[model samples]
Target chain A: MANIHDVAKAAGVSISTVSYALSGKRSIGEETRRRIADAVRELGYRPNAGARMLASTRTNIFAVTAPLHSGTYEPAHMAFVLAVTRAARAYDYDVLLLTEDEATKGLRRVAASRLVDGVIVLDVSKDDERTKLLRELDIPAVVIGIPDDTEELVCVDLDFRAAAEQSVRRLADLGHRRIGLLGHPEQIYARGSNFPHRFRAGFLDAASALGVDAAFAMPGHGPVGVRAALDELFEKQPDMTGLVLNCEEPIQASVLDILADRGVRVPEDLSVISACSSFDTTRFHPPLDVIPLVAAETCVRAVELVVEQIAGAEGPHVELVPPHYSEHGSTAPVPDLRDAR
Target chain B: MANIHDVAKAAGVSISTVSYALSGKRSIGEETRRRIADAVRELGYRPNAGARMLASTRTNIFAVTAPLHSGTYEPAHMAFVLAVTRAARAYDYDVLLLTEDEATKGLRRVAASRLVDGVIVLDVSKDDERTKLLRELDIPAVVIGIPDDTEELVCVDLDFRAAAEQSVRRLADLGHRRIGLLGHPEQIYARGSNFPHRFRAGFLDAASALGVDAAFAMPGHGPVGVRAALDELFEKQPDMTGLVLNCEEPIQASVLDILADRGVRVPEDLSVISACSSFDTTRFHPPLDVIPLVAAETCVRAVELVVEQIAGAEGPHVELVPPHYSEHGSTAPVPDLRDAR
Candidate 1:
C-alpha cells in the first residue's frame, strides 16, 4: 500500500528523484539508489511507474503447486493445499494454486512472470525436479515434504519417521506380539516418496527396538489391491494381532471390513492404528487410533516459513513437527490369542 | 500475445495513436479512437503502458472463490473447485483460490484490484449475497449452483430436481412401491441450500405422479443421524423397500452397515439409490446406485461459461445438465413384500 511519495520521504529524497532512479529515465548516485531500494523493500512498495515493473513485481500472491489434476485424487493432498491457502491469508497474502499439467512448468511460469512472491509445493517427491528450479530462483519457497538432499532448502513435514515409530510403539506397549503394517502403494516407495520410505524405516526400527515382529505390505489403491495386500501380510504374520495403516486411500474401510469378515474383531482379536491425518474418517468401522499427521498445522507452519524466507529470514531451515497421536477407537489390548498362536 | 504494434497495424493507426487512445495521455480523433478500441478488444492486448493499467487490465487469472477454509470439509466442493482449476487451465488461465475469511471480501478484492479477469464461486447458497456484487462488477463471473433467482446471472449446477425425480422414477420402474430419502442435514435445508430443497420437491412430485409412498429425513452428520433417520422412516413405513440417499456426510458406509446389521439385504429386502456427485465414493461399502451429479463436468462448463463471458460474450445463461446415473451395485428391485402383505 506504500506509494512513491512514502518511498521518497522514507529514503529522504525528492519525489522526482525517487521516480527518476526507479525509471532509469535519468541516472542517480549509487548511494542514493541503494537508499531508495532499501526504502522500497522496507515499505513493500508496488511501484506504479511504467518502467519499474521489476521493483513492483511482488504481487503478494504465493503459488501453491500440487499434483491435483494427476491420475490419482488424494483427498489429503487437497486438504493440505487448501490449508495452505488459509494459512497464507493470515499473512495477508492470496494463493494462486497450480494443479494442472507439468507442475514444474507452472512453477517456472509463475516465478519467471513475477506472478507470485513465493511458493509452497505439496506432495514433493524425493528426487523432486522442481527443487532444483526453485533453488536457482530468487523467489522464496518451501516444501511440505522433505526431499533426498535438503541442502540449501527450506522444508517442513509431519515427522513421518516419528509417527511410524510411535504407531508401532503404541501397539507394542499394548502387549501385541505380532503386527502388520499396510504401507503406501509400491510405486510411492519406488518413486522414493519421502513419507513412505521414512515411515517404513521408522516402523522397522521401532519393531526391532521393541523386540516385536512387524510384517509390512504396500497396499494397492482399490479393493482387490487392499485385500491382496492384507492377505499377503497376514499370510506372512498369521498370528498378527495388531495392525498399522499408513495409507489414506479408501482402503481404510476395506481393511476393517476384510478383518471383520475374517472374524477379527478390532482391538479384540486385532488392534488397528492409522498413521494418517486426523481429518481422515472411515465410514463403516470404528475410527482408527490415529498418530496425527496434523495437516492444517503443518500447512500453516510451511507458509510462515516460506513467508519468513521471503521477508529476508536467513538460512536453509527444516521444520519437523513432532507427532501428536489421537486415539479414537481402533486400539485395544491383544486378546487371548494362544489358540491362534 | 498481441502488442500495441499489432493494434496499431490492425487499426491503421500509428503506435503512438493507439497508445494515446489506450492511455488517454493524448487526444486522438474520434473515428481513430473507436478503431483503436475495437482493435484492443479484438486482440485482448494486456497493455503494459502505465496509465492503461486501468483501461486495459486483463490479468488472465480466474479467481476460484469458495468457503474452503470454513467449518466442514466437503470433498465434493473441493472436487468441483479443483475441476474448475483444471478446466480453467485448458483455456490458458490459472486459478487463484480465495478460501480464507469472508468470500465476498475476497471477491471484491480480486475484481477491484484487477487481479483476475473473472471468478467462479462454488457452494453457492440459495440466497447468495455474492451474486449481487458480481452483477455490479465489470469482470465476468459464474456460479456453480443456481441460486433462488436466475435473472441476469450465468449459473450452472447439477439438476438436483431431475436427479431426485430420476432416482424415484428409477426405483418405481423397478417396482419399488415404498421408498425413503435420507436428505441433507436439517440445517442445510433450513439455510435454504437450493439442492436439498429442489431434490425433496422433485422426489415428492415424482412419487405423487407414480402413486408411490415416500418418506424423508433431514438427517444429522454421522452414523447416529443415519440410524435415527432410518429408524424413524422405517418405523412409519415398516415395510419400506427402497431408499434414496441425497446427502454427502460420512453416512454412506453407515447406511450400508446399518442395513446389513438389521438383517436387511440390499436389492433383496431393500433397494438403494444415491443422488450425489459421481466423484463420491465410499471405500469400504458396495458402491451405490448413483445418479451422477457430474461435478467435474459442471465445473468445466462453469469455467468455460465465465471465461467466454470474460472474452466479451454476453449472457444471462443457465445450463442444467441432466443426471447420468451409474449402477455401482447398491440398488435393485424392491423386496417381494406381497407375501408379507
Candidate 2:
C-alpha cells in the first residue's frame, strides 16, 4: 500500500532522487541507490505503472521474442523462456512474450510505443528476419542464439561447437575410434537453426582432427526415426563404438529404448553421451553422460547484457558460455578387438 | 506515423471522440465506432503508450499467469500460451507472461499497478492460490482451468469430464468390457491438477453405469513406467481389451513401444483412445482415435470472455467448451472372447 512519497520520506531523499535511483534513468550516487532500495524493500513500495513510465521515460518491461519453429523441442524452448522471465524478474522487469506468429510486427509495435525497455530474441535462425529488424529498430536487444551475421547485434549462446568437440575428445580418450552422432530431425538442420548446425560442424571437424571415423544422422522423432538413424550410422561406420546424441528429449529416450531392444548395453557394447541437452539425462535407464545446455547460465547472462545495454553499455558483441561435461558411466574404454573376435 | 489528431481529422471527429471510441471507455455509437475503426486501419494509427494510457486509463495488455509445475506437459502448456497470445492479438492486446516462480506476486503487482486490463490463469490446480487472489483482486480475469471453487470467478476449459466419459463410451460400444486408462505421473494427481481428477472420475463413473470393468494406472514416465503400469493394469484386469492414454506425449509413445514389444496390435489385440490430448495423435505409430483437448477453442473463447468483462459484461460464470472426437482406426469391435480362449 506504500507509495513513492512514503519511500522517499523513509529513505531521507528528495522524491526525484528516489525516482532516479529506482529507475536508473539519471545516475544517482551509489549510496543514494542503496538507501532507496532498502527503503523500497522495507516499505514494499510498488511504482504506479503510469507514474513510473512518465518519470523515467522507460517501461520496466522486456519484449521476449521467442518463435517456436516446427522442429522446436518444447521443453528446451520453455526452459529458456522460464529462465529469461526469472532473470528479468531479478531486475524487476516483466516479460512480454512475442511469439513466432507475431514476431516482427509485435517487436515493431512495442518499440514504437515505448512499451518495453529492450528486447530479448530467442530461437534465432541463421538468417532471421527479426535480427534485421532489431538492427533497424535501434533498441537495446540481446539475442539468445547466434545468427549468421552478428554485425551490430548483441548475442549470447552456448559454445555448441566446443561442446561437440569436447564430446568427441572424451570418447576418444576412452579409446573409441569410430563415433556416430544422432542429431535433431532433418528439418531442424535444413531450416538452418543456428545451434544444430554449429554442433554438427564441430563434431565433424573434431572427428577429422582426431583421425576417427565419424558418422552423423538426423533422428527425426520416436522409435521409427531412431531406428532409421541408427541404421544409417551403422551403414556409414560399421565398427562404430561411440555415439553422441544431440537431439530432443523424446528422441534421445527413443534412441536408448531402440538400443536396449537390440541388446546393446551402454558403456559395454557402445559408449553413449547425451550432448547439449536441456533436460536432465540422469533419469534415463542407464543415465547417459551429459554436456548440459544450461538455460539459466545463458539466459541470465543475456538478461545482464541487455540490462547493461539499456544503461548505455559498450558496442555489440557475442558471448558464448563455455560448456561443461558430466559423466554418468555411459562411456567406457573400447573393447579390445582381439578379445571381441 | 499517424497520430490522434490525424485520425480524428480523417474521421471528422474531435480528438476526445477518437480517444473514447478507441478505448471503449464510454460507449460510442455503432456508426461512429465503425468510422473510427476504418480511419485507424486506413491511416495505420497506433497509440503512443503514455498518451494512450493517460487518455483512456486502459493498458492494451493482458497478464497471462501460467505456472509450470513439475508434471506440467510442456508441449500442451506451450500450445495454450501460444493460442491465448494469438487470440489476444486479434483484439490488439499483448501478453505479459507470469511464470510459476512469480505467480501470485506477479498477478497482484500487475493488477495493483493497473499494468494489464485482465488476467488469464493457466494450469490452475484444485487449490490454486491465484484463483483466491483473483476473487479478491477486483480486476477482469478468465481462468483457463476450473479450480475447486468457481465462486465469483470466470472459468473456461475443455469439458474434460465429458471427454473422459466419451472415451469410455467409445471403447465400450466397441464391445470391450475391460478397459484400462494410463494416466499421468502419480505426482501430477497428488499435486491436485484439476482436469486429470475430473477426467478420472468421469471415466470411472461412465464404466460403472455401462456395467463394464474399468482399471486405471499412473504411468510415471519412459519405458519402465509404461511397463510397470501395464503390469498393474493386467493384474487388476487380466483380460483388459481396451486402453485409454491420458498422459504426456512421451509416455504415450512409450506405451505403444512397450505394447509392440509384447506383440500387442492396436484395435485388434486391444483398442486405444488418446483422450484429451492437445498434440496430434495421427503421428503415433498406429494413429490413435482422439478426443482432443483443443487449446485454441478454449483459449480464444477465454480471451473473448475476458475482453467482454473488460467492457463490462455479465457476472462471473464458468463456460465449458464441448469435446469433439476424431477417429484414426485405433479402435474397432473387440476381438471375440471365444477365439482367444
Candidate 3:
C-alpha cells in the first residue's frame, strides 16, 4: 500500500537513505533510523520484492525442478529440498520449487524472466533435457543427480557404486554366499532412473567379483506386491542367504513375514540391507543398516555451487559425496543352510 | 540466444505478430506461420519468460504452501498438492510449491512480484499468519483447510466432524459399546491442526450421544512406541471393542503387533477404522477401512475458486466435501467379550 518514495518522504530522507536503512547495508544516524522505522510503521510499507530485485540485481531466490509424483516428495527428498532451502536462507535466498513438467516451459519462463538467481535440478535423467536447455540458455544450474555428460555442468552425485559394493561386501564378510537384490520396478530403471541402475550395476559387479550367487527382482509398492516378489525370488533362488533392497519405500512387515514363512532369521539365516534414505531409516520398522540419503547434502552443495557459478566464479565443478552406512544389527554371519536342508 | 526481435526481423513481421504466432493465440496465414517457424528455428530464438510476463500480464502460475516433515509427507497432503498441480495444468497454469517457513516471505514475494496469479494455501490454521497477510494483500487466495474466520475467504474443507460421526455410527452398527480413539498427537491439534481437532470433537460428541464408552490416545512412530501407547490404552480401558486410528503411519504395524500380542482377533474381537489417505491405505499392510485422502480434489476445487475470484468473480464461496469410507474387511460386529473371557 505504501511505496518507497512515500517512506522516504515521511522519513524526511532520500530514497537511497530509506533503502540503506531497510537493508542495513549502510550505516545511518540513530535518529534517521528511528524516523525511517516510524515512517515504515505509519505507512504499513512492506518493501516491494520486485523493486529490490531490480535495484540490487539479486532476487535471492533459487529454483529447483523435479518430478511431481506422489513418491517424489518422499521424506528423503523433502529433507534434501529443505536442506537446500535452509542453506539458501543462510545466504539470504529463498527456494522456488518447480515440478518437472512445468520445468520445461514454466522454469524456462521464470529463469529467462530473472525470477531467481540460480536453480538446482533434481531427478535428473542420464541425458537430461533440462540440463541441455540450461546450458543453451547459459543459465547457472546445478544438477542433483548425475547426467550422462558432465563436461560443462555443475553437478553433485552420490557414489552409489561404492555404497552398493560396500553393502555386498558386508554381506560377503558375513558368510553370505547367495544373495538376493530387490530392486525398484523395471519401469524405473528401464525409463532410465539413475540411482537404481547405478546401485544395481555396483551390486551385481561386486557379487560376481566375490564369486557369490546373486538373484534380482523388481518389487512394487505395498506388502502384497513385496510378498509376491519376495516369494518369487525365494522360489527361484531358494539358497539365497542375504538380501539387498534398493526399493524406495521400505517393505518392513512383508520382509519380516517372508523371512518367517521361509523359516529364516534375520542376520542369522538371511541378512538384510537396503539403499535407504535417512528419513526412511528413521521410520523403518527394524531400522535398516545402509547409507544415509546423501541427496540432501548433495542438494545443499549443488545450490552453493550454482550460486557461485551464477556469480561468475569459474568452470563446471562436480562433487561426489561418499555414502555413510548405519549399522543397525540387521547383518551378521550367515547361518549353515546344509544342516537345515 | 536469438531474441524475439531477431526472429521478427527475419520473418518480416512485427514482434506482436511473432508473439501471437508462437503462443498460438491468433490465426495467421499458412505462409506467415511457416516463415515465423523457419525464422525461429534458424535463429534458435526462444521467448524470454520475464519480458513476456511483463507484456502479457499472465504468467500462468499458481503457488502452493504446505508442511513437509522429514520422515512423513502425510499421504493426504501429498495427494492434495498433486491434485492442485494437475488441475491447474488443465486450466493452463503451472503450480509453484512453497514450504511452511517460506509461506510468509516467499508467498508475499511471489504475489507482489506477480510471479503467480493466485495461491492455494493448505493445512490452514485457526489464526494463520499467512491468511492474515494474504487478506492484507490484494491478491486472490484460496484456503484448503478451514480458517477461524472464513467470512471473506474461499475455502474447500472436508466435513471432519461429520466424518467422525459417520465412523462412530459405523462402529455402533457393529454393536461396539466401548471404543478406543487413537488420535494424532495433542501437539498437532494444539498447533491449530484443523482436521484432528474437528475429528476428535465429532468422535466425542457422537460417542456421547450413542452412550458408548470411548477413550482417546495418540501413538508415537514405530512399533515400540505404538505398542506402548496401545498397551497404555488397553490398560486404562481393557473392555474397548472398537479402535479408531487418527494418526496413520505409526499405527499401521503397531495395530497388528498389539493384536497379536494381546491374542485379540480383528473384526471378531475388535474393529479398526481410520481417516487415512488413499496412498497410506495402499501402502498399509492388511489395509484398514478408511476415508480416502480427498485432499487432491479439495486442492483442485480451491485453486479453481481462487482463480475465479482473482478474475473478479463475486461473493464468498465454500465447498465442503463429505468423507467417503472404504470397507476393507477391517471392521465387523464386535465379538462377545464376556463369552470369550
In terms of TM-score, the best-performing candidate is: 2
Q: Write the residue-wise lDDT of candidate 2 on A1-341 in tens digits.
A: 57889999998999889877876779988788889999999976777786567556788999999888645778889999999999999998999999977888899899877889999999999999999999888889999989999999999999999999999999889889999999999988888789999999999999999988899998745677789999999999888999999998878888888889899989888999999999899999899999999999999999999999999985799899999999999998897652576
Each prediction's TM-score versus the true structure? 0.78, 0.89, 0.81
lDDT against true structure, model 2: 0.90
The root-mean-square deviation over C-alpha atoms between each candidate and the true structure, in angstroms, is 8.6, 4.5, 5.1
How do the residues A1-341 of candidate 3 rate in per-residue lDDT, one tens digit apiece? 67889999999999999989988999999999999999998987866555566566666677777765544535555556667776777677766667647766656766766777888887777777887888776778888877778778888888788888888899898788989888886667766657777888899999999988888888765666787788778887888888988776555556765677667777676788977445455345455677766655776677778778877996786777788888988887777844555
Which tens-of-lDDT digit does each residue in B200-254 have in candidate 1? Answer: 9999999999999999876665667889999988987998988988877356667
> Each model: TM-score of chain B?
0.81, 0.89, 0.87
Number of the top-ranking candidate, with lDDT as the measure: 2
Decreasing TM-score order of the candidates = 2, 3, 1
* Tens-digit lDDT track of model 3 for B1-341: 57888999999999989989998999999999999999988986767545555466666667887755333335456566667877787787766677757767778767866767888888777778887888777788888877777877777888888888888999998889989888875567778877788788999999999988888887765566677778777877898889888776646556766686678877667888877444555444456788765766676778778778768994666668888888988888878744665
Residue pairs with colliding backbones in model 1 are: A267-A270
